[model samples]
Target: MTSTVDTVDPAAAEATEVSRVVISLLKGVVYQSESAQVWTLLRRFQARVTDHMTVMGLDLVIDEAEGYAHLRQATFDEANIPRLVPRHRLSFRVSLLLALLRKRLAEFDATSSDTRLIITRDQIAELLRVHLPDSSNEVRLIGDVDTLIGKVDELGFLRQVKGQEATFEVRRIIKAYIDAQWLADFDARLQAYLASMDGDGEPRG
Candidate 1:
């Protein structure tokens, strides 16, 4: 039989895998776009990666079926490692839009026969409008909706479909982060938003 030492260096293999996983997550979310190489690496070394990142106060969120992975700050203690991944503070409107998109994605997953759920700008606008106060300025409302969509796109929850204008693919990470616990109180939250949106057609504290 061949000697194990000649066949593989266990220490070197672990180091290389750790480097690849860390570098990939540092760059941003790892989506299984064209290849599953990273997914394989992540699964094989997930424990080790978790151990390594936990020291820096970060945790990995990975979904095999969704084919994506990202890191989030694991702790908030002042004495801990400085938060490497800064938390994103979303405005109220932005938060509402994200919730709406996440709800739509859930609906699509339940009702659609197609494997993918893609929506046009108009569809998203229609979905949001029902929750908003009636506005006389239709154009301005649409523009605002477009701006919100752009913000979602920037946050990586919404992706513009290639070769299609005014269309987007709702990335699955939204569901991963927005848990069922959040959805459980979603209705009451929306009602509170409606209450907060003062009669002047603006949402305010």
Candidate 2:
């Protein structure tokens, strides 16, 4: 004699899956490569997850081509509701580093066959150093650049390569933030910034 039992409920399982995916997205970005199972569940229950986010005044942003998903706050013009997400004001150094990286990523995409853009800490320092108005204190400048890189990493635009020293992979999500239009005027904007910094006689942050 054999005893067999089936106890799984389809509706409950699906509901649980959606909840899991929603929670994962709420926590932070869910990358297809980093979280394959969650990404699959998200794609499977995208509508459900989006519906849930909408209820919370949030929107689900997914880039299948880039294989990343995250949550954004929905705009409500008239509704007097407290925001679940906080807006962060990035410092000058962090912003500058991000712009440089975005420009580099664009150039890389145009010339290289590889999608992944890996850069070393020294390379990043050199990229920023050339644009700086002051370079008298090499040690201080390098330290400041490292700090800016750390900020970018915290913002999820740069990921450190495991088992590698001072190497990072530029996350493609940066493209979503710095669009094609931004890149079109990048050179002019960069020159303007440099001119302003030179006039100030001191680099700000």
Candidate 3:
């Protein structure tokens, strides 16, 4: 009896590795710090991965300085191609929270040498309190702040510090989405929002 052995081709094995990187990116944001090996593979096969994603009508966004990468829907006018990625509409309050966090990140980048910005729950609440409608119930106010924080966390911009209580590390990837232009535009609208506040500090429509 004769036995035959099949061996994997080197090219096929490399292609498989690249595919794994692409799959990881499709799932969600890939952080270099979280998976150094995967990140290396991504950089090694970026072009190939990008080509594969382009075929699916998606664009790969990578910020090397920030050490993060994610996929976004391509903006080209391809009406025939349906979107594989879904667009999420954030509530006004949640948008406001994101804007506030983005602004804080800018301020931190300017003054501090450290790349990571760690903030406490109380600090976030205090930062947002002025913009929010006044309330007599302290407990309710805390709950509201917690809810907003949760939303931000779910969006992948705020990561809770392990072994820490109510403390989070604001992910630097936020700078990619909320650029300087958007921040400036939002600042004007925020002033208008503040001006529209009623006697009780609630924004009046």
TM per candidate: 0.84, 0.88, 0.86
In candidate 2, stretches whose alpha carbon ends up further than 4 angstroms from where it belongs are 1-6, 134-139, 198-205
Superior by TM-score: candidate 1 or candidate 3: 3
lDDT of 1 by residue, 1-205 (tens): 7755556788998899888988898877888764478778888889988888888788888877777899988766576467798778987778888888888888887898765679999998887777776666334566698899999998889989999999999988898778878877898999987777755545775
CA lDDT of every candidate:
0.82, 0.85, 0.85
Model 3 quality (TM-score): 0.86
Pairs in clash, predicted candidate 2: none
Instruction: Order the candidate numbers by lDDT, best to worst.
Output: 2, 3, 1
Considering summed lDDT, which 10 consecutive residues are worst modelled in model 2?
Answer: 196-205
Return the candidate ranking by TM-score, descending.
2, 3, 1
Least well predicted 10-residue stretch by lDDT in candidate 3: 133-142
Clashing residue pairs in candidate 3 (N, C-alpha, C atoms within 3 angstroms): none
Candidate 3, residue 130: the lDDT equals 63
Q: What tens digits encode model 2's per-residue C-alpha lDDT throughout 41-145?
A: 999999999999999999899998888998888999967977887777885567778899999999998899987999999999998887776656545656777
Cα lDDT for residue 123, model 1?
93
Predicted structure with the largest TM-score when compared to the true one: 2
